[model samples]
Target: MANIQFRLQSSTKEKKPISVRFKVGRKTDVTANTGFSINEKDWTETNLPKKNNDVNKLLHKSLLKLQSFLEDRYNEALTDSTVIDKFWLSNQINECFERVEKKDTGILANHIQFIIDNANTRKVSGRNQIGISKSRVKGYETFKKIIEDYQKTAIKKQIHFLDINKTFVDKFTNWLINTRNYSKNYSGKQLDNLKTVCLDAEKLEIKTNPYIKQIEGFAESNEERFIVTLSFDELEQIRTCNKITNDAHLNARKWILIGCEIGQRASDLLNITKEDIRYKGGRMYLDVIQRKTKKSVTIGIINPYVVDIMKNEFPYKVSTQKLNEHIKKVCEIAEINEKVEGKKLNPEAKKNKPETMRKIQNFYPKWELITTHSFRRSFASNYYKKIPTAVLIQITGHSKESLFLNYINQREDKDANADLFMQFYERLNKDKEPGMTVIRNAQ
Candidate 1:
C-alpha cells in the first residue's frame, strides 16, 4: 500500500515550507518540497494545518486535494509502468497545481521554465559551461511570474510563441507601463529578455512568430539618467576624513578607498583576500573573475592612496550591507553635502512592487547618493579623458570599449581627430602649390 504524509522541515517560529513524503510498501520512500508553506505555530503535530483560521483551513484543504490527486495518478500510472520517484512526484504536484504547466506543455511560460531549470547546462559561445548566476535564475523566475500574471489579467489564456506578435507586444508593453507601474527601462529589459528567450527557442526548433525578428523593446535614452561619480577632490575628502572614530566606519573607509582605486564590483572587491594579491614586475595586483560577467580581471594597485592604505594593514572583511551603510555615514562626516542629480533604489518601497517612475528619481546630496556602485563609476569618470580609452577599458576589465564608454557616462567627441586631419591637410598643401593639381603615373 502507498501512503502520503506531510511534515515541517524546521521548528522555526516563522513560516516554513511543508515537506511531502511519499512511500510505497518498503524502501520506496521519498521526500520532496510540497511547494507550500505554513507558519510553525499554525501547524499541528499530526502533519496537518491546525485550521485555526480560514487560511489554515484552506491550507489543509489544499494538502488533502494533493493527496487525493497523487493517489489517483499513481494508481493510473501503475498500469502504464511509470517509474515512481521524486521527479514523477514533482511533476504530479506541478500538474495538480499550476505553479508551472505540465512538463509536456510547450508554451511561452514552459520554455522560460526550461531555461530556468537547465540554466546550469547552458554554455556561452558554445564552449565553457559557465552557467547563469543564481540571481539571474531568480530574475528569470520573477519574469516568469510577471508573464503568468500578464496572461491571467490581459491574455486571459496561456501565451504561445505563435501568439507573440505585434499585437501582443503592444498590449504587453502597455500593461507593463500603465497597469504594473513599470518604468520604460524596466519594461524594456523584460521585453529584451523575452526576445533572448525567443531566440534560444528558435535554436531548439520551436515554433515562433516570424515577426519576433523585428520585435524590439522601447526604453528611455541613457542620456536621461544621471550617472553619479565622485570628483577627485571629493574622493580625497572621504579618504582623508579624520572624524571617523567608530571601528566599523574606519574599516569601511579603507574599503571605499580601495574600491575606488581598483574599480571592482562589490562582490569581487569584498571577497578578495591577501592570498589573491600577486606581484608582477614590481607592481601589486588582485586577480579575480568578475562575479557578474565571469570575466577574468587582474586589477593593478597603481593608486598611491590605496597603496598607502594597504601598507599599514588590509581592511577587515565586512558584509556588503555593512560596508554600504558605513560608507554613507563616512561620506556624511566628510561633508560631501553638494546636491547631485541622481536616482537611487528605494529601500522602503513595498515588496513585489517595481521601484519605478518618480519614487526613486530625485536630486539628493552627494553623500546620500554615494554607494558601492559609485566606486567604479568614480574611477572611470576620473581617469576617462586623462588616460587612453583603450588602456582604461583594459583596467576596467570591460569586454568592449563602447560598453566601457557608456558605463562611464562618456560620449566620444566626434571631432577628436580634427587636429590630425588639419595637420595632414597642412602637410599635403605644403608639399605643392595651393592651386596645383598633381597626378601620379599608373604603375
Candidate 2:
C-alpha cells in the first residue's frame, strides 16, 4: 500500500462547510478543511452538493468534509494489505472509466492499427497514403532484420512484449557498430525503432522500461575512411581489354565505362534510355533525376570517347549485379589488382570445410562483397580529383560541399600525394646534375 496521508482541520473562515481531504504526494498539499485551496487564496470543496454559498461557509463545510475523508483513508490504511490490493483494482477501473468519459483514445493501438489497415487498402487508401518507395522499403527491410534479431533475444517468457534492458541494447548497438560496421546514423535508426517499441510497450503495460537513458552518440568520429578510385591507366586497361568477345557484353562494357566517365548511380543508369539524351541551350546533355535522392543531375560530355561508347553500344538490359560481375572479370583479365566493391554470388563457405565455402549463392549463407554501389563511389572519387568542386557538385547532384567531399577516396589522396612528392624530388635532382660538382673557387 502507498504511504497514506490525510489533512483534517476546521477552517475558521465564515460560511464554509466541512469537507473531506486527501493528498497523494508532497506535490499535492491540502488546506485545513477537506477543500483544496485554489492556488493560495480561495478554497473549493469537492464533496459539497451543488449550491450557491458564501466563501467562509464553503471553507467551513469543505474543512469538515476533509476531516471525514482523512478518517476514512486512515481506517483503510490500517486495514489488511489484501484489502488495499482490492481497492487499487477498483481505482484502476475507475481510472479506465474516466478515460472513456474523456474520449481521448487517439493514441491507442487501435488507432495505429487502423492507419496500417487503411494503408493496405487498395486504390483509394494505398495510393493516397504517404507511401515508402521501393528503395526506402529495402532500407526498412535491412532495419527490420536488426529488429527481428534483437526481438529473438530480448523477448522473455514473463513479458508479452520485448523486455528492453541495457544488456539487450548494448548487444544490438555492438552488433551494428562493431560487427556489421554500420555508420553511426544507421545504428541510431535501429535504436530509434527500439525506443518507439518501448513507448508502445509502456502504453500497453506489457513491460516496464529500464533503459530510459539510452542516447546514441550524435558526435561523429574523426576517423575518415575513403574508397579507392581506379587510376586512368587502370580504367583504360579495363575498357580496352581483349578478353570480352561478346558484342552485346562489349557494348554493356561501354555503358559501364560511360558510367565511370560521368558519375551516375547504377539505379539511375539502369533506366537511362536514348530518350533521356537532350541537345538544348547550345550543348548536348543527359538530364538525369537520381532515383535515390530525386535530385536533378545533368552530364555534358563532348568527349568522343564517351560519345563513341554511347553510340556504338546497342542497348541491353544488364542487371547491376551482372554488370558488377563483368567489371570484376574484365579487371582480372586486364591484370588490374585494385580492390573494387562487388558482392559474392556464392554461399557462405561451410565451417571447417574450405571446399564448401567456395560453394555458390544457392546452398547456405549468401555473402557478397564489393557491391554495385562501389562503382558510384569510385566514380565520385576519381572525378573529384580531376574536376573543380563546384562543377563536380553540379554533375553529381551533391547539395553540400561536405557531402561531395565525403565521396573522395582517402587512399587515392595518399597515393596521389606520394606520387606528387616523388615527381618533385625527381625534378629537383634533374635540375642539379647528380654528380657534377664544380670546383668551388675560394671566394
Q: All candidates' lDDT scores?
A: 0.80, 0.52
- TM-score for all models, in order of appearance: 0.67, 0.52
Return the lDDT, model 1, position 23.
Answer: 96
**Which 10-residue window of candidate 1 scores lowest in summed lDDT?**
350-359
Which candidate comes out best when scored by lDDT? 1
lDDT of 2 by residue, 1-443 (tens): 23333322444654343322234455433332322332223333544333345754664455454445444544653442212333232232233223223222222232223233443342332234454456544554555455544444432111112224565567667766765555565577767745654554466554444563463434234342334455566667767788877765575567656777677778887788777777767556888888766678888867677776565553576887687766555555566664434223234342433223222222211112333555566677776646655677777777776777665633324465466567768988887756967997898
> What tens digits encode model 1's per-residue C-alpha lDDT throughout 46-91?
8899989999999999999999988987887575455677766875
Name the weakest run of 10 consecutive residues (lDDT summed) in model 2. 359-368
Q: How accurate is candidate 2 locally (lDDT)?
A: 0.52
Residue 306 accuracy (lDDT) in model 2: 71
- lDDT, candidate 1, at 300: 76
Reference-based TM-score, model 1: 0.67
